[model samples]
Target: MNIHQVSVNYAPEQDRLLIRINGKEGGELRAWLTRRLALALLPVLNQSATAQMTKLAGPAAPAASLDEQRDQLLDTFQKEALLRTGDFKTPYEDRQGQPANAVLGPEPLLLTEVKVTLMSSGQLRLQMLEKLPGSDTVRNFQVMMDGQLTNGLLHLLHQSLNASQWLEPVAPANLTPAGSSEVPELAIEPAKPRYLN
Candidate 1:
């Protein structure tokens, strides 16, 4: 959809984000974006040794704490997305890959302007500037017969987006040694066909 305006306000104290749209509310857009952001930030967060150290020193430390933290982070992130939309019916999957269809109804109003702001407290704010339109921007919705089919498409999209970083020349070890002594010769076989008299 044609985005008319975009603004993002950050509220560092809240550790959340808000997103708004002006024209026709984009279905699953918020989830898609939150997933994107989480994917982008998760590695950095996980790699933060200082954060890990602090958590280790915190109260009630347990062996599963790290995993718990990851779950909490993801939950918080999705919650932030929900808050931004204000239309709660958005579908989101939990850490266990279970679908949580908490909210229901028509999608939120779409706006021409999409604003995203990350507050200092790590909160994100999204604002959408919408305008009335004669025609609907988003027209089609299809349910995939299999969940894996949808997942496969998402995986392909993710791979395409991340492919740049993983693109490297094949290592020498991965290639056949040019001067190696062993070489196999191709075998040729003749086939004969008989015609009935």
Candidate 2:
């Protein structure tokens, strides 16, 4: 479906991020992202965004040749450039007063699994699923996002996460690689991506 707008907000009471996607064709898809899922999903999102940035950079400039620091700087520059051009100031249009346009159901889907892959068309494909308890039921939904939309979604998720105070302890200041003076042997493993068919 063609997306019209995307919204991500933290719900303090639910302690989860509410993602609402309004399709240009007239339906809205809502999902709840819990802390556990967010922790696993954020890194994958970052990786995918970086991949897109590198693809846009083209074959002339290979990201592999650059040092870690330089590559990071380039990624930052690309992300900022794309983000600056996006129209994030416009408020997300929700189907509140009008007839319910929730395509899934009245309540948001409680996401149990998420998979993401960069498509051949240079768009990010996202698949979110909800597995019902005590039954063999798994409802799924899919959406494709361009680089700008991916970056926008990442920005929104980061803002909501900060507001939720869930990453305060592991904030940028506190993060240290293995064998550092501040923290030692920080057994952090690289994010393993899930394959999507």
Candidate 3:
């Protein structure tokens, strides 16, 4: 979508960011971009950090202010999309003699939408919605983080959006009963997918 206008306002009490993106085609997207996600995108949108520094700067252009930061964020975001068309890697492994390769069931279902959320712990939570070949039935899968990620990896995430693919998801050992108020020490958990919806 061609973006026309954008805004980012911080809510200190809520520790949240209010982002509104207006597309040229009249579509509007609104979301509360979490602090971690904003932190993650800060470097990408910062002028001094990315390669766009030289080109985006012209003699008359003004330094990035609060308003421009939102524009920069939107500019940086177009390249980094949230939708998952059809890119997924099945688990694989190789051993000494047997060469144990995890069996990849069948061709993966077409992924309709994927949501990525940055947790306060500096980790990302990915929830994917995939559909069967010729039906409306869609199943959801999450790219589960097996362990705590290193600070370096987390830092790299600020630099690169594609770093998400490097993560792997696994099925939970035991399903938690629905409506369980207990946090599993892990965030396990869609709609079609929206910036905030």
Best by lDDT: 2
Tens-place lDDT digits, model 1, residues 1-197: 33222222222343223222222222332222233353453344233322332332334333467888887666655643432342223333222222122241233333344343333333233333334468644322212111222222233334433542223454433333588866555555798898999
- Model 2 TM-score? 0.72
- Please identify which of the two predictions, 1 or 3, would achieve the higher TM-score against the true structure: 3
The model with the greatest TM-score is 2
Per-candidate clashes, comma-separated: 45, 0, 0
lDDT of 3 by residue, 1-197 (tens): 34344344445665455443344455444444444555555443342222222223322345469788777666545433321111223221211132111121222323444465544443344454555478766655443221122122233334333322212354556556689966465554534555875
Off by over 4 Å in 2: 61-80, 96-103, 170-197
What CA root-mean-square deviation does each model show from the true structure?
20.5, 13.4, 21.9
TM accuracy, model 1: 0.19
Whole-model Cα lDDT per candidate?
0.34, 0.82, 0.39
Cα lDDT of model 2 by residue, 1-197, tens digit = 79888999999989999998888877678889999999899999999988876675554444565586597777777755974366779999986333224356677889999999998777899999998789676767899998889988998999999998998786445566787766544566899999999
Q: Which residue pairs come into collision in candidate 2?
A: none
Error of 3 at 180 (Å): 34
How many clashing residue pairs are found in candidate 2?
0
Model 1: ten consecutive residues of lowest lDDT: 141-150
